[model samples]
Target chain A: MTRFLLQRIGLMIPTIFFVSVIVFSLQQLLPGDPALTMAGDEASPALIAEIRAKYHLDDPLLVRYGKWVAGIAQGDLGISLRTQQTVVQLLTQKIPVTLELATLAMIIALTFGISMGILAAISRGGPMDYVARCIALFGISMPAFWLGILFILLFAVKWRILPASGYVPLTENPLENLRSMIMPATVLGLAVSGVIMRHTRSAMLQVLSNDYVRTARAKGLSETTVIFVHALRNAALPVITLGALEFGQLLSGTVLTETVFSMPGFGKLVVDAVFNRDYAVVQGAVLCTAVVFLLLNLFADLAYAAVNPRLRGR
Target chain B: MSPYVLDCIHPFARGPLPAKTGKTLLFAQQAGRIEPRTASGKATAWQSEGPPQFLLDVRDLRVTSSGGYPLVDGVSFTLNRGETLGIVGESGCGKSLTSLALMGLLPPGMSVSGQVEFEGADLLKLAPATVRDLRGDRLAMIFQDPMTSLNPTLTVGYQIAEGLIRHRGCDRREARDRSIELLRKVKLPAAERRFDEYPHQLSGGMRQRVMIAMALICQPALLIADEPTTALDVTVQAQILDLLAELKDDLGSAMIFISHDLGVVAENVDRVAVLYAGRLVEEGPTRSLFEQPQHPYTIGLMGSIPRIDTTSEWLPAIAGTLPLASDPPPGCRFEPRCPFAGDKCREESPDLAEVSAGHRAACWKAPL
Candidate 1:
C-alpha cells in the first residue's frame, strides 16, 4: 500500500509540471501586457521600458518561465505589480479567508448533500425525494452569483437575520465569524451539493440493487441497516470523488461567490489582480489553486484505498 | 400409533402413506366430522391436524410485478425441517423471484399473493414490521456473488454478527464470539485473525463463507439460498454445497435452494420443483424426478445435463427460450419449447395433476 501511494505521488510530479507550463503560457498569451497595463496609458515609453526591465518582463518568454520555475524552487513568487507587495505576503493574507470559506462550504455540502441524497434514494418516489430533486435542479441551474444575491436578499436584506456581506476573522469571535460566513458558505455549498447529491443518489440507487444488498436483507437486518450500512458505504466511492472535486472547485471558483457576498477572500484578490494586471499575484493565486486541487485529488485517491481495501491489492 | 393420531399430532410431518390402523382412525375422525351419506363434501377440507415438521409451507404462491403481471404464478412447495427443496429454472423463470417473495424482500412496486406460512403464521398477511422481525430470526437467505453480497466497509466478523445482534439481541461481545464460532464452522482459516478483515480483504470463497455464516448465525428455522454457489469455481461450488448440507443438518433448518444447476440441486435437495416462466411445471422427490421426470421440461432438463457415460457428439439442448412472464403463451408456458406440444397443449393450460402418488406434473403429454 505504501509502495502504491509512493507510485501515485511520484506520478504527480510530471502532471504538475505540465500543468504549470500550461498555466504560465496561457497567462503570458493574454491580450493585455502586464507591464504596459501597470504603467497606464499616460506613462512615458521610457518609464514603461524601465518598469518592464525591472520586472524582467523584457526577457524571452522561455527564459522568464525558467526564471519563474527557479524562483518557485526558492519559495519566491516575486512581487505584485498593482499592490506593490510580495505575492507571498498578499497570498498569506488572502488564502486563509478563501480556505475558511471553502472548508465551511465543503462541510455544509457534504453534510446536507449526502444526507439529502440518502433521503432521496430511500424515499425514491416520495414527496421528499421530489423536493430534493427540485432543490438540486435549482442549485445546478441557478448561477452562483444569482444564488448568492438571493441568499443575501432573503436572509440579510429582508429578514435581517445576518449581516448582508463581510468576512469576520475567526480569531476575533468564532461564533460571529460563523454567522457572518454561513450565508455565502451555504450558497456556495448548495451549488456544489447539487452535483454531489445527484451523483450520490444515483450511485446509491445502483448499489442498492446489488446482490449484496439482498444478502444483507436476507441476513434479517432492518431496512435502515441494509440501506445505510451495506448499500451506502459501497455507494460512497463516487460521492467521495464528486465531493473532493467540488472542494477543489470551491477553493478557486469562489470568485463570483465572493464578489456577490462582498467577502475578502483569495477569489476576490485574484479577480482584483486580474483587473489590475498583477501578474505575480495572479500567478501565485493560480498556482496555489492548482496545488490545492492536486492535493484534494490525492486525498480522494487515498480515501478510495482507505474505504475499499480491495484497492490495496491482496 | 394410529396414523390419524400421528397426523393430528404432526400434520406437516406426514409422509406419502399412512399405516393401516392410522388410516382407520382417520376414517373414523372423518366420519365423525361429516355426514357419512355425502359422496363428495369439499374434499374434507384438506386438513392435516398436527404440529408442523416443515418449517415453511408456500402454497399456490403468486407474485406479480407492479404492472399486474405475475412473475411467480401458482408456485406451491414445502421445506421440511433439516431438508433442502431445490427450485431450478432458467433465467427469468421466477426462481429468484420465488425466493424473494418468500422472504418478503421484493422491491417496491411488486406485490405477492397466496399463502407463505412460515412456522404457523401466513407470512403474506404479516405486517412489514413483523416480517422484518421474522426475517433473520426464523428465516434467512444467502445470495450469489459474494464479492457484491458482503458489505465492503464492514469487518467479516461484524457483517456475520449483524444479524445475530439485530434479531437475536446478542450483545456485541456475545455476537462477536458467536460470529467467530460460525466462521470456524464455515472452515475459514485463523478465524480470529480473519474476524477483523473486511470483505475485500478475504478471498471470494472466504467472503462467501462469511455470507453463509451471517445467514446461519441467527439459527433461523429456514434458509433460502439463491444461487449461493453460482459465483464460485466448480471445485469451490462443491465444497460450499457440502458445507451447506452439513450446516443444514447441524442447524436443523429447512432450506429452499434455488439454482439453475440441476447437479447441484440433485446433490443438496430432497425435493425438486421445475419452474418455467413463473409457473411450476413439475415437482416430486428429487430421486424420482431425476430418474423418471414426469414433465417434458423436466425431462429436457435432465437430458440436457451432460452425462459422462454417453459419448455422443452433441448433448440434448432444451429448444427455444423460456417465454416472458408478461406475454406468456395461452396454454402452457413451455409449450413453445416442448417437442410433445399438441393442439390441446396449445389450447388449455394444464394445472399440476397427480401423475404418480406424491408426484405432480403440469403437462398434457406427461413423461411416461
Candidate 2:
C-alpha cells in the first residue's frame, strides 16, 4: 500500500508539469499587451516601450517562458505591472478569505446534501424524497449570482438580518467574519449541494441493494445500522469523488460569488488582473488555483484508500 | 367429529378416501416424543401437540412481487427440531424467494402472505416490530455467496457479534467472547486472531465459516441456509456441509436448507421437497423419494445425478427448460419438461397426492 501511494504521488509530478505548460501557453496566446494596458491611452509610445523593456518583453517567447518557469521554481511569481507589487504578496493577502469561504461552503453543502440524500433513499417514494428532489433541482437551476442578489435583498434590505456585502477579517472579530461569510457561503453551497445530493442518493440506492445489506437485515439489526453501517460506507466512495471535484470547483466558483458579495479574495484578484492584463498576477493566481486543485485531488485519492481498504491493494 | 371439526378436516381430505386412522397414528409416531395423551380427550386435541419442538413451519406461503405475480406460490413445509429440510429447485424456481420470505427479509416492493410459524407464533401475522424482535433471537439466515454476504469494512468479530448484541442484548465484551466461541465452533483455526481480520483477508471457505458463525451466534431455534456451500469447492463444500450438520446437531436448531444440488440434499436433509417453477412437484422422506421418485420431474432429477457407479458417457437431463413463473404453461408447470407428460397432464394442474403411505407427488402419472 505504501508503494502504491508513493507511485501515485510520483505520477502527479508529470500531470502537474503538463498542466503548467498548457496554462502558460494559453495565457501567452490571449490578445492583450500588459505594458499598454498598464500605461493606458494617455501614455506615450516611448514610455510603453521602456516599461516593456524593463519587464523583458523584448525576449523571445521560449526564453520568457523558461524565465517564468525558473522564477516559479524559485518561489518568485514575478510582479504585477498594474499593481506594481509582487504577485505572490498580492495573492497571500487574498488567499485566506477565499480558503475560508470555500471550506465553509463545502462543509455546509456536504452536511445538508448527504443527510437529504440518506433521508430520500430511506423514504424512497415519500414526500420527503419528493421535496428533496425538488430542492436539488431548484438549487441546480438557479445561478449563484442571482441567488446572492436575492439573499441580499431579502435578508439584508427587507429583513435587516445581515449586511449585504463586504468582508471582515476573522482576527478582528470571529463572529462578524462568520456572519459576513454566511451569504456567499450559502450561494456557493446551494449550487454544489445539487451535485452532491444527487450522487449520494444514487450511490446509496445502489449500495442498499447489495447482498450484505440483506444479510444485515436478516441479522435483525435496526434499520439505522443496516443503512449507515453496512450501506453508507460502501456508498460513500462516489460521494468522496464528487466532494473533491466540488472543492476544486468551489475555488473557481468564488470568482462570481466574490464579485457579487464584494469580498476581497483570489477570485477578485484574478478578475482585476485579467482586466488590467497584469500577466504576472494572472499567471500566479491561475497556477495557485491549479496547484490547489491538484493537491485536493491527491488528498481525495488518499482518502479513498483510507475509507476503502480494498483500494490499498490497487 | 362435530361439524366445525369436520369442516376443519375437509380441506385435508380428498376423493372419497376412508378415514386414515392408521396413517394418522403412524404420523403421530413419526412426529415423535409426544407426552402421553392429555385428559381433555377432545377431538383434534393433537393439533396443539407443541410442534415436536421443531424449528420452522412455513405453510401455504404465497410471496408476490410488486407486479402482483406470485414469486413463491403456495409453498408449505416443516423443519423438525435438529433436522434439516432441503428444498431443491432450478434457478428462478422461487427457492431463494421462499427462504427470504421465511426469514421475513424480502426486499421492498414484495409482499408475503402465509403462515411462517416459528416455534409457536405465526410470524406472518406478527407486527413488524415483533417480527424484528423474534429475528436473530429465534431465527437466523445464512446467505449464499460468502464473498458478498459479509460487510467488507467491518471485522469478522463485529459482524458475528452484531446479532448477539442486538437480539441477545449482550454487551460488546460479552458479544465479542461469544463471537470467538462461535468462530471456534465453526472450526476456524486461531479464532482470536481471525476475529479481527476483515472479510477480504479470509479465504472463501473461511468467509463462509464466518457467515455461519454469525448466523449461529444467538443460538437461534431455526437457521435458514440459502445455498451456503454453493460458492465453495467440492472438498470445501463437503467440509462446510459436515460443519453445518455438526453445528445444527450441537445447537439443536432446525434447518431449512435450500439448494439445487440433489447429492448435497440427499446427504444432508431428512426430507426433501422438489420445486419447479414456483410449485412443489414432489415431497417425501429423502430416502424414499431418492429410491422411488413418483413425479417424472423428480425421476428426471434423480437420473441426472452423476454417479461413480454409472458407465454412461452422457448423463440424462430433463429435456425442456423449466417454464417462467409469469407465463407458466396452462396446466402443470412441469409439463413442458416432463418426458411422461400426457393429455391429462396438459389439461389439469395436479395437486400433491399421496403416492405411498408417506410419499406425496404432484403428477397425473405416478411412478407405479
Candidate 3:
C-alpha cells in the first residue's frame, strides 16, 4: 500500500505539470487582452501599454509561464488582477466552502444512492424499485441551478426553514453553516446520487446474479446478508470509482449551483477571475482542479485495491 | 440397503410375463411391469408405514418460467439415506435448475411446484423462513464453477466458516477452527496458511476444495453438488470427485450429484436419473442404466461417451440440439432428436413408468 501510494503520488507530478501548461495556454486563448480588460473600455493605448508592462504582458509566453510556475513552486500563485490579493489567499478563503459542500454532498449521495440501489435491485420490478428509478430519473433530468432555485423557494421562501442564499463558515457557526449549505449541497448531490443509483443498481443486479451469491444463498444466509455482505462488497467497486470521480467534480466547484446559492466557492472565484481577465487566479484554480481530480483518481485506485484483495498482491 | 436394491432383486427373480402398453409389448426379461393405480396411493402407503424410508422424495417437481412455460417438467425420484443420486443431462436440459429448485434457490420469475419432502416436511409447502433455516443447516450445495462460486472478496476460511456461523451459530473462533479442519479434510495443502487467502489466490482445485469445505462445514443431511467438478482440470476433477465421495461417506449425507458427464456420474453415484430436455427420460441403478439404457436419449448419451474399447475412429453423436423450453415438442421433448421416435412418440408424451421393479423409463419403446 505504501509503495502504491508513493507510485501514484510520483505520477501526479508530471500530470499536474501538464495540467498547468494546458490551463495557462487555454487562459491565453480567451478573447480580449488582459491588459486592455484591466485598463477599462475607454482607456487610451498608453494606459493599456503601462498596465501590460506592469503585468509583464510583453514577455514571451514561455518566460511568463516560467515566472508563474516559479511563483507556484514557492507557494505563490501570483496576485489576482481584480482584487490585488494573491491567488493563494483567495483560494484559501474559497476552498473550504466547496470542500465542505462536496464532502457533505458525497456523504448524502453515497447513503441514499447505495441503500436505494440495493433496495431497488433486491426488489427489482417492484413498487419501491420503480420509485427509486423515478427519483433517479428526476434527479438526472433536473438541472442543478433549477433544482437549487426550487429548493430555495420551497425551503426558504415558502417554509422559512433555511436561509435563501448566503455563506457561513463552519468555524463561525456549525449549525448555521449546515443550514445555509443544505439546499446547495442537496441540489449538487441529487444528479450525482442519480448517477450513483443507476450504477449501483446495475452493479448490484449483476453481482447478485453471480455464482457466489447463489452459494451465499445456499449457505442459508438471510436475504440481507446475501445481498449486502456477499453481493454489495463487489458491487461497491464500480460505484466507488464513479463516486470518487463525481466527488472530484464536486470539489472543482459547481458553477451553476454556487451562483444559485450565492456561495462564494472555487466555481464563483474562477468565474469572476475569468470574466475580469484575472489570468493568475484562473491558472491557480484550474491547476488546483486538476490536482483534485488526480488525487481523487489515486484515492479511487487505492479504494479499489482495498475492496478487492485480488488487486492487492500485485 | 437401498429399498430399490432389494426391490429390483425380488422382481427380477420372479420372471414376470410381457406387459402390453397400447399395441407394443415390453420385454418380460426385466420383470415387474404392473402399473400403479395412482401416484397418491403409493405416497399414502409410504406414509402409513412406520417412518419414511427415503431421505429426500421428490414427486412431480416442476419448474416453470413466469410465462408458464416449463423449464423442468414433472420429475420424481427418491434418495435413500447416505445414497448418492446422479442427475445426468446435456446442456440446457434443466439439470442445474432441478437442483436449484430443490434448494429453494430458483431465480425470480421461475416458479417451482409439487413436492420436495425432506425430513418429513414438504419443502415446497414450508414457509421461506423455515426453508432458509433448513438450507444451510440440514441442506447445502456445491456449485459447478468453484472459480466463481466462492466469493472473490472473502477469505477462503471465512467463506467456509460462513455456513457454520449462520446455521450452527458458531462463534468466529469455533468456526475458524472447524473450517481449517474441513480444509484439511478436503486435502487442501497448507490448510492453516491458506485460510486467509482469497479465492483468486487458490488454483481451480484448491478453490473447489474450499467450496467442498464450505458445504461440509455444517455437515448437512443432504448435499446438492451441481456439476461440481466440471470446471476443474481432468486430474483435478478426479481428486475433487474422490474428495466429495470421501466427505459424503464421512458425513453420511444424501447427495444429488448433477453432472452432464455420464462417466463421472457412473463412477460416483449409486443410481442415475437421465433428463432429456425438461423431462426424466430414464432412471435406474447406475450399473443397470449404464449397462442397459432403456430410453433412446439415454442410449444416445451412453453411445456418445467416447470409449477406449471401441475400434471406431469417430464416436457417434446425438443429433440435433435440445429443443427450447418455450417451444417443446408436443409429445416427447426428445422426439425431434430421437432416432427411434415414432408416430406415438410425436403425438403423445409418455409418462415415466416401470420397466423393471426399480427402473423407470419415459419412452414407449422402453427395453429396446
Q: Highest lDDT, which number?
A: 3
Question: Per-residue lDDT of A26-112 in model 2, one digit per residue for the tens?
Answer: 888999888888788899999999998999988988898899999999999999887778988998899999999999999989998
How far residue B148's Cα lies from its native spot in candidate 3, in Å, is 1.4
Angstrom error of the Cα, residue B334, model 1: value is: 4.0
**Per-residue lDDT of candidate 3, residues B181-262 (tens digit):** 8898889999999999999998999999988888888889999999897777555666687788888888989899998876
Tens digits of per-residue lDDT for model 1 on B170-213? 89999999889889999999999999988767888888888889
Cα deviation of A119, candidate 3, in Å? 1.9
lDDT of 2: 0.81
Error of 1 at A236 (Å): 1.4
What DockQ results for candidate 2?
0.50
Candidate 3 lDDT over residue span A174-218, tens digit each: 999999998898988888899999999999999988989989999
Give the candidates in order of lDDT, highest first.
3, 2, 1
Indicate the residue-level lDDT of B227 in model 3: 89
Model 3, TM vs. native: 0.90
TM for every model, in the order presented, reads: 0.87, 0.89, 0.90
The runs of at least 3 residues in candidate 2 whose Cα sits more than 4 Å from the true structure, single-residue gaps closed, are: A1-5, B1-53, B341-344
Scoring model 3 with DockQ, what do you get?
Answer: 0.67
A1-314, model 1: which lDDT tens digit per residue?
A: 88887887898889878878988888888788887888888999999999989999989999999999898899999899987889899998988988999999999888888889999998898998999999988888989889888888898989999999887899999998999899889889888888888988999899888877877777667788788788888899988888888888888889998888788899899989888888888888888888888889989988988887778763
The full ranking of all candidates by TM-score, starting with the best, is 3, 2, 1
How many pairs of residues collide in each model? 3, 0, 0
Who wins the TM-score comparison?
A: 3
